[model samples]
Target: MNTKMFCYQCEQTVGCTGCTGNAGVCGKKADTARLQDELTGALIGLARAVDGAETISKRTSQVIMEGLFTTVTNVSFDDAAIETMIQKVRAEKERLVPDCSKCQSSCGKTDEYDMQQLWDANEDVRSLKSLILFGIRGMAAYAYHANVLNYEDAEVNRFFCEALFKIGYEESVETLLPVVLKVGEINLKCMALLDKANTETYGTPEPTAVTLTVEKGPFIVVTGHDLKDLQLLLEQTEGKGINIYTHGEMLPAHAYPFLKKFSHLKGNFGTAWQNQQKEFDHLPAPILYTTNCLMPPKSSYADRVFTTEVVAFPGAVHIDEKKDFTPVIEKALELGGYKEDQILTGINGGTKVTTGFGHAAILSHAGTVVEAVKAGAIRHFFLVAGCDGAKPGRNYYTEFVKQTPSDSIILTLACGKFRFNDLDLGEIGGLPRLMDMGQCNDAYGAIQVAVALADAFGCSVNELPLSFVLSWYEQKAVCILLTLLHLGIKNIRLGPSLPAFLSPNILNFLVKNYGIAPITTPEEDIKTLLNHNK
Candidate 1:
């Protein structure tokens, strides 16, 4: 029960359980892990203080969401940054309950809960509460992104505090069960909020073709899922004799009209976040990460990594609220990029990829899509998307997409699309069969497509010939999965592996009630999914 660092929140937890040593499997140091725990504890106290009648401040919302998200898997590796977030949480708590500190009588009513107690609790209770805690951590990232664009939902904003309150106060399994599922319910709204913010600010993403070439010139490669950060960086770097390339989750930025208006905004550079160490090694450009999916930098690229917002790594230059891009710009100029245009390809070796199939874009062509299905030109639909990771088993997604029937369409989002997005999948009704729906939070868009399809056919979502084959790496995927289950979508095929935190009882319940199963080979699972239609 005495563990220095215990983290089992993601698909890559060491030994399929917690990482209880120097670092987690994802390269988080022991000290960083402890700071994350401290951050969580402080966030809980902040949430507890704001639980009742007080109208939570906008800054309080930002701090709650950003602090929780900062602790997600690979998002923040800087202990100093994490401590700063902890201080923000404490300040917010004091702002909410100013009298608690100065009162003479002893009272422990609003004190921060020690994380060790939760870690040492009964396994089932811990598992349920963990779901609530981890699920919201993922939701917070989406909320933060939306908040940056001046989009805020009162219900979605309050849920963070409520969920954190439950995580800190509710101990019994029965009381926590509903709260655990509420995280899923709230996350859907949070994702929708982000979708509105992004689309309104950047325009609905259209099906635009993006190249994998790094144009000749000094350039900056931007990664992560924050479009607002990308937008500001694009504005700052315009007309500076530099090219801008998207990488990882930022690939979809190229499809947004508002961003693509910048002529210097070039093409995408590398693949998913997991490949950064190899992809960025000795690169002639600086990388500005706007959010999560940052690996611990290799010394080769350590000096070139620039982080903004909640994404911080030790020794990397951080851009604060000032949104200054001077350091990143100077680094790019010093590196002086390739002498000539360099072509890059995805893992499957295609020179170009296509994205921007947001819900509005797809539904705008809904009549044509429905007719194609009626004419038997399209046989089925598959959502083969989620977060990507370093595990070799992730190749399953690539193979699954590759082996899908030519008449079927693959709707993908998040970094997982890097596995198969570069491949040409042909088209039906002017829409490529393989459609990229932006980042993970764009799961909101995917859900919209599903609901629209169901309404068009006058049947339930599960009644439609659609299958979900998901690959999860982090907590964002957890919230999305819970949202799917909340919608009563059944028989999902999840892999590279199930999460390590789910207790035997919780896992069994998911299987029995939701018909969720771990994925087998692409060949067998695809056949099973296709057969279900008959």
Candidate 2:
């Protein structure tokens, strides 16, 4: 196999196999892919170095988390940025064991492990290790967000090094399998950490209606999953005569009291991240990407794109840690937005969408929900959530939501909801049939709600008429799915595609033990789920 690179970390990989040519399906070039692999290998070596240290510092864990996050699909595409990350990993290793590299004995313990070894390993081993690696990469994103908000969990931080060390050196199935499942266990804690950070900082999200109308004036469109970046932007742009609109995963920011207080924080701008290139074409407003799901910018609106945090693209203005929004604001003002309010609608052609149904908001009405459930007003619950991508079969989600029985409640998170979120599913017993539960990290809230429901009903979650019809695209979805599996949840129907990295043996194990299966047609799956619920 004479290939330029090997990458299957995302669901949209080439032909459901690895992306081995010049660029990945996410538009990451081969050079960038190679640099990311190198960065991962370097992080592994740093983890190995930390293993010998008496203690792991917060900074050490932070670097490990950042490095892992940097390699997640569609994140850092800049070779220079990836190389800088590699250097940061090495610098962290040197800080931990200054004299180790200077040793004449030259033990391989501290040397960077080549990622190609893992990529070329036995099928089952590769599958399991990929699960662990991808799961933590997703977990790191949550941990990073929480860390920015001054939340730190020593256990979560330590597991980064432990997972990296195992990925680099461990080969036994017995050893790696538990580590793979443990990624899910740790990620649950990480999501909870992020949940605490978000709710405490921004205030617990409440149900709020976010319009799709872009008010006339200078406006900046904020996308990706960073609420802190959105808050900072909201603060800096307040009273600047510039309106702010949430895009993609940032749509949940509107539900936060601290964020919604900004009068200029008008409404949502666009749909999921995959549609950005089309949606952003010649957009008059500046678009700021605070995190991943960034596509290669088309020349039309390339000049209006600004990246902050770990997100970097060549030639686009990069916002450093100083968090200044001058350039973005100035761009917004210069572009002079629409002459009139541009009314945008979701894919389902609805002008308004609602969000902020976090655990607190949902649980606040738990008594009502419980009464409805027991009275048969709400027959079942469907968690139709996960990442959205530019793929063919994703219409399955839109159709699935539409075909879901009127008596069932649709609990959604992440961008996948963009498919049918705007459709009027009506309400069940005073509650909207569809509830958007924040971002993908807000999967924590969904889990909390499920567990609470189960406790109220005196049964396990799997026995509570709840079904997970998830659509995954990238690593974040991977970690969330693993978290579900870790909790002993069963019969999850995942699509638009299963991960390419899953070997037949590992897939069989999951199918046999966990009852995980790829999604079939929405009509068939809905009928099957309803029948199963009965």
Candidate 3:
């Protein structure tokens, strides 16, 4: 088949393999996907060239991060933005290796790989490289968020180049497996750096319950992965008769003391990342995207979309580096919100959801959790965490949570929790059955809890009766998944579908080596899991 530009890197893509003929399930045109692939290819080339350079500048790192991140699912739905990123990558390459233009012979080392070649490579080779590429793309989003807060880790930045360089090289499962785990190890540090930046800058998150209702009058909805941008928005819009509500991963921002201190910083407004198109369609408030998970806007709310940091949408107002959010605030006031307090509920009709069960909160109750487990009150632990989307099969997560044995503990994080977060799962041993461990980046906290439990039990993490049933949608999930793989944690069940970018050989390798399985029916999977534990 002569593939066109469309791709199915996400869980929900047209026809499962990829959207080559026309538009994607997310409504991205074929041409846009092609441009994004071009940008990614250029980024891979740049990283390969800069891998061991003596003097790679901060600018090189920043562009590499931005270029990879922009290709993440639903981040840049605009063709023009991808084109701009391609140009930026090209310019960076020109600056780094200016002699490329004058050289008589071409050195394939610094040249961009046609993405089609990757797509057509041996299935196993393509899958391994895809793992490195996609994993870093997701990690870059987190790195970008942390970078904006002025927190950067040298190792994290360097591993990004290492990972990218590997993507361009020919390698096998033996060579790639170590690099795969390396992605996870590096992602763990990257996540910790972000955790430190977030907790230190904003106080350690305390347990918080937020409502879904929007109070009367003007309000602004802030979405994406960046907290600093939301904090800045909250600051600039404070006391201006404007309310700030969270959307997507920003839902956890409500639990941060520094953010919650703002009186007008209101509650969350929607479900997971995938519902934005419908939810924001007629929304009166302006939405400011500080990071990823941005969908192309509907014409009705297009003018009201505002972006800051690297989250640019075509034609929407951008706040730029200065972070002056006057335009976003103005849009909110202009929209003027509801005439009365609008009462809304989650998928379960619950008016509120509680969050902020980061490592601090979970560890504070560690003694209790340990006692409960020792007493046989809590039998097993399930970490059902990752990004959520609109795919029909994603109901598997909600079903999986519901099907967990009563003696088990469920620790969830990220936008995926929205699927069943509103349900009153009640408590086990004085701890809520479902603990929202902050955003996707806060997987660091979940890992901390696992390690602490392992230490208490005097065993390795995999020996602590812990199971990771993960759902992935974008790049951040990729990084976290890599982290889990790096930890040598086996018997993971991933769903609702495998990445279309992964070749059959790569999938088989993961299955044979890591015991990674696709999600089956909840009953079947639960039975299989219980048998394994037994």
Q: Which candidate is the best by TM-score?
A: 2
Cα displacement (angstroms), candidate 2, residue 517, comes to: 0.7
Give lDDT for model 3. Answer: 0.85
lDDT against true structure, model 1: 0.89
Q: In model 1, which residue pairs have backbone atoms overlapping below 3 Å?
A: none
The CA lDDT of each predicted structure is: 0.89, 0.91, 0.85
lDDT of 3 at 318: 74
Task: Give TM per candidate.
Answer: 0.97, 0.98, 0.96
- Candidate 2 error regions (>4 Å): 1-3, 52-54, 102-106
Please provide, for model 2 over 48-162, each residue's C-alpha lDDT reduced to its tens digit, 9 standing for 90 to 100.
Answer: 8877555679889889888988998888878898899999999888987897667888576788888889988999999999999999999999999999999999889889989
Q: Each candidate's root-mean-square deviation in Å? A: 1.6, 1.4, 2.0
| lDDT tens per residue, model 1, 382-414 | 999999999878999999999999999999999
Instruction: Arrange candidates, best TM-score first.
Output: 2, 1, 3
In candidate 2, position 110 carries an lDDT of 82
Looking at model 2, report the run of 10 residues with the lowest lDDT sum.
99-108
